[model samples]
Target: MTEDRKKGNSSKWRPQTMMVRGGLTRSEHGETSEALFLNSGFVYDSPEEQSARMAGDKPGYIYSRYANPTVRMFEERLAQIEGAEDCRATASGMAAIHTMLVAPIKPGDRIIAQRQLFSSCLWILKNLMPKMGVEVTWLDGSDLGQWEDATRKPCRFALIETPSNPLLDAVDIRAVADLVHNAGGELIVDNVFASPILQRPIELGADWVVYSTTKHMDGQGRTLGGAILGKTSKIVDELQQYYRHTGPSMSPFNAWVVLKGLETMDLRVRRMSDNARVIADRLATNPKIKAVRYPGRSDHPHHNTHASQMPEGGGSMLAFSLKGGGDAAFAMLNRLGLIDISNNLGDAKSLITHPATTTHRTLTEHERAAIGLDDTWVRLSVGLEDPEDVAEDVEQALAGR
Candidate 1:
């Protein structure tokens, strides 16, 4: 480990310690694993106690929609892992994104966001926000100048996704946060790519951090969930109203699954990131590969920034373009036997997807091209497989193509 990494707060204990024991809450039984509460609402022992709980005079869960022990355990554990003052779990990542964005801005407000995003996220910003009377401006996310320019205008919110989907683009979270703060706006970072294991946007000065727990947190394809973390004031007082009333709360069973997923997340992410580094290096030397983008690799545009921001490594995700285009990509995908042809990331098994037709299909051809998602672009989510096998499978697939 680097000297800086060896001496930080997290340096004292390895990531595994943080992942397993960071936010454990045991009941009187002292169970080894986090408990699951499946009930929709908690019953009171007495009418007076129930009234007091309802009036916020006592501290206990009144309804599952508002809170549950399992959901609270997941939230608390994630908050501790993220080093945030508060957190709330949503039914899915998009639900977390929607609640965070829609809850804060009023009609006639303005939001500045990065242009490259998940297709669903792009639709939320470009299509949904305008309809709600919130004007939005799209800027090249990596361009600090464009961020400054956009923030200088009257903006209430800013949305960014570091190591963006499909393209693996990155933005300086601290610099952008500074600019957003100077212009009187809150910066929300979608940290799904880096996962909490690789990046902590709140420590970088972002006002809020969101995650698609469906990805790395689960480290498997078993469940779908999302979370938002920030200071206690906005999370409890402001964001809670929108989250609870919208009824997008995470199910207790899903929360229990995610809770278990967290125990080994750090290990899974580390191994996956290592695999990504190896694959990225091998892919870069291939003649059929047009370009490769992995934050861990030095060839990436923001390698230095990613190095400073992500202490563990770039992450388990990377994207590359083929020399022969979309047809070539399909041929390679068809021949691949080890890696699954799926868009989901942060799984125990390797997966691949073509962004042009799958994730970014919502965009027009011109818009998709503008974001560097060409027909040949293939996104790979490295898993806990042997690096040699992964590399050989990719090479064999490309050869058949």
Candidate 2:
């Protein structure tokens, strides 16, 4: 802004302002919108310069596999909004998440993670990582006691999701971060559900914060991308090797799409979050719903921690159980007209999903029970619709349409 330019530092700009303008790299023509560098390679000005750039003695793009102007703009803008020292984009949200867990890990290194995570994340921790000769342990993230107990032993990495997927469970980030740090481990937070507009894990002492930019960062559901942000070498320098070699780089085109998404993310998330608050209240009073968990409500078991941890109130995600069980949940989802029944969340359109049958299906009945996910439970990602309309559709569905 003209005022900000006079103030002399972009860092002083607020979150919404940063999201729109932070990572801009104007081309020679200085287009009003960001330019998409769609090519996979850049031409060298000279062989000497190419050799210098290739050898890392200079700063310029060598290959699109690791770096692109459009992707870098998205990374920088998000980093500024999130207050992260640096950021890197990836192919998908899961790519960012899986990479965050595996990037700093190796054989024989132990990792501790919360049990309530997206199924893909669970696979990495419970299935894939163990097969790689790494020891993995799971804990109830809401239980600080469980966190402390698990981190008391020396471990290389600790992973958790605040307001975890579908369930909305929250934990004290600072308390867990200190414990992990004391044990010579790093705390990596997946702050996907609670977008940077609502939470900044880095400010809460997290060593690294990761995002599935596919979700709220690209609030319109236009693209798939992921990012890892931190102020440490582990993310800036070390993780670069893993990202470069694994070929999980994000598309420069998707990055540009997300750049447009970021410009309006502040408005979209806040509106959706507001809609969620209203829908949660309506669901709580419904006779057909057995239980409701929303971070903004005082009745939520972890509402206090959520309030302390997230500067904004509860986000757009909420979970509820039907008094009529899975059949009723499925029927209700089938009846909805305005809301979509999909595995995806964080979209301009409202979405509903039965966690047991979809996102967590890989977990056995026994494993699902262990995590408090049951057949009747449904997860809702509130959207940019009228709150009354969303609530009415849910009510009519619960009432058998």
Best candidate, TM-score-wise?
A: 2
How would you encode candidate 1's per-residue C-alpha lDDT over 45-156 as one tens digit per residue?
9999999999999999999988998888788778878888889999999999999998877999888888888889998988899899999989899999898788877778
Query: Which stretches in model 2 have alpha-carbon errors above 4 Å?
Result: 1-9
Task: Judge candidate 2 at residue 131 and give its lDDT.
Answer: 82
Model 2 pairs whose backbones collide: none
What's the alpha carbon RMSD for model 2? Answer: 1.9
TM-score of each: 0.95, 0.96
> What TM-score quantifies how close candidate 2 is to the native fold?
0.96
How would you encode candidate 2's per-residue C-alpha lDDT over 57-112 as one tens digit per residue? 99999899979999998888888888888988999988998888777778999988
Model 1 — which ten-residue stretch has the worst lDDT? 3-12
